[model samples]
Target: MQNIENKVAYITGGSKGIGFGIAKILVENGLKVAISGRNLDDLQEAQAVLGEDNLLVFQSDVINFEDEVNSVKRVIERFGKLDVVIANAGVGKFAPVDEISLDDWNAMIATNLTGVFHTLKASVEELKKSKGYYISIASLAGTNFFAGGAGYNASKFGVVGFTQAAMLDLRKHDIKCTTIMPGSVTSNFADHVPSDSDAWKIQPSDLGEMVIHLLQMNANVLPSKIEVRPSKTS
Candidate 1:
């Protein structure tokens, strides 16, 4: 197993939901964490809740390459080094293929797929120095298709494929990479509010635990692609 104490981590979309959950876990595990979001208010709120001692908050949009680059730079500057980078910023829009607007499709592509690319590209150099871990929060939709999921499916599928290829590429440099594909997570993503209907679904903190487990895995082991789902249907 790897020793993860006192390491530095940067997580995109870390203001809420799964990203926030993961950031909390990292901080609890003695890892210095930098959490980024486009909303400074949300970021500040998270920082207050998480703690100021080992947490850094940044305003960033993963869809913007410069934002990603600056976020990474800020993390490195504040922490002196970065050992983990998680790309968890994403948006979802569900609609029939014919009903999906060009704008919606483009938005999903830019934020979900291209955003992960930007995050990885901006942090890859720092990761190489630390032989760190790079993780992307994809979705089960990457593999399974539903009736109203053309745009989302395309973006997630791209994320899965991109993460796998990145994993193979980074392994040679001793940098680990993985994609976490989850199903039916209870969160307010894409304007959906979590309620009792989602009790049977995966919780945001479950992903945080999964990341902690991955970080503690043996250096020789790499669970590159993980799919987590609810134990039972609701």
Candidate 2:
């Protein structure tokens, strides 16, 4: 396994849910992690849970390119170098195409699709310097369409395509890009509070473990895309 000690990682949407889960694992394994979210309170709460050492919390909204640029600057300023980035910020709006409001559709596209691009654009230079890894958290909805999922599906599909092309572009630089498509994760996504009933679904930490696994693989080996789900249906 590759030695991850003292490396730095920046995760967007890192204040909670899957992002927080990944941040926690990375910190435990001796990485310095900087997590960004739009909510200062959520970021603070995460800092408290994860503790101060090896963690930095910043407030950032992924939809804004300027915010992402500032976030990368802050991470580099704090940790010296950025070796990994996880674009985990996203939103979901479930409704029929005809019924989905223009505002909701725009929000999904901006946050879920364009936001990923902004993160990559802002950090690509630093990632190139580190020859790092970029991982985006997509969804199974990217490949399988379902009723009332028009907006979410479109955004996630775009993410899958975007990440694949990015992988091709970055590999020559020794940078790895991967998109993780998960099914039914037990997260506070879509405003659903996690509960015991969610035990059967994939947990945030499971994805965290996967991230570690990817990071530890041999330098020449790359799993460009991964689709993960619970072992049993919930």
Minimal lDDT window, size 10, model 1: 188-197
Which clashing pairs does model 1 show? Answer: none
Candidate 2 per-residue lDDT, tens place, 1-234, comes to 788889899999999999999999898888999999999999999999999988989999999999999999999888899999999999998999899999999999999999999999999999999999999999999999999999999999999999999999999999999999999898899999999999999988989889999999999899988999899996
Clashes of each: 0, 0
Over 173-228, each residue of candidate 1 has an lDDT whose tens digit, in order, gives 99999999999898879988778888898998889889999999999999999999
Q: How far is candidate 2 from the true structure (C-alpha RMSD, Å)?
A: 0.6
- For candidate 1, the clash count comes to 0
Error (Å) of candidate 2 at residue 24 is: 0.8
lDDT of each: 0.93, 0.94
The candidate maximizing lDDT is 2
- How high a TM-score does candidate 2 get? 0.99
